[model samples]
Target: MSDMSEAPKLDDALGSLPGSRNFRLLADIPVRMSVEVGSTSLKLAEVMDLAEGSIVELDRQSDELLDIMVNGTLIAKGEVVTVNNRYGIRIVEVATAEARMAGVERRG
Candidate 1:
């Protein structure tokens, strides 16, 4: 008969694993999220002449999807929607898992 007592035992407790516990800790951490509709550059004089009703065109078209940023990194694209008279974004596309992990690595 072969002796198998020398091998290490695998841990079954979730909290005993450093990676699992660390991720659980990070799950509670808050991150800032923002939605970008569009942006435009205007001269100082042009910006100063703006009035309440003045309209300034943006770089993106009105029908274009908005960008969803997490801690300043683009993670998804969405569109604006109204819910109960409040403005919100409906996510249309999300970044791949690899891309999202890369973004987190870059931020860290």
Candidate 2:
């Protein structure tokens, strides 16, 4: 096997770039962004039993941070906020570039 330790880091690869033009080129590209409040899994029987007024419990606590995703990959965590009766997210933490890349790789 090759020495994996010899592989260049993600930061190193990015830092080696000569200019920001390559990065700027992608600035106009659009990506899907979403926020996940929580999730729960149910058996087929339970799923079928869901009704209009049914309440399903999620794994995450109400006070917990929500997952912020881009193109289905988690890139940050945030909390819900309300402004003028409109709902929004208040970003509390962001994942490192390496973490974001790792998420993309996992999904790929």
As a whole number from 0 to 100, the lDDT of residue 43 in candidate 1 is 95
User: Whole-model lDDT, candidate 2?
Assistant: 0.86
Tell me the whole-model lDDT of each prediction, alpha carbons only.
0.82, 0.86
How high is the lDDT of residue 53 in model 2? 98
Best by TM-score: 2
The pairs that clash in candidate 1 are none
lDDT of 2 by residue, 1-108 (tens): 144599886556656687756765675789999999889889999999999999999999888899999999889999988877999878799989999999989987
Consecutive 10-residue window with the lowest summed lDDT within model 1: 1-10
The digit string of per-residue lDDT tens for model 1 on 33-86 reads 999888999999999999999998889988889999899888999998787799
Q: Model 1: runs farther than 4 Å from truth? A: 1-18, 97-108
Return the TM-score for candidate 2, rounded to 2 decimals: 0.77
Q: Which candidate is the best by lDDT?
A: 2
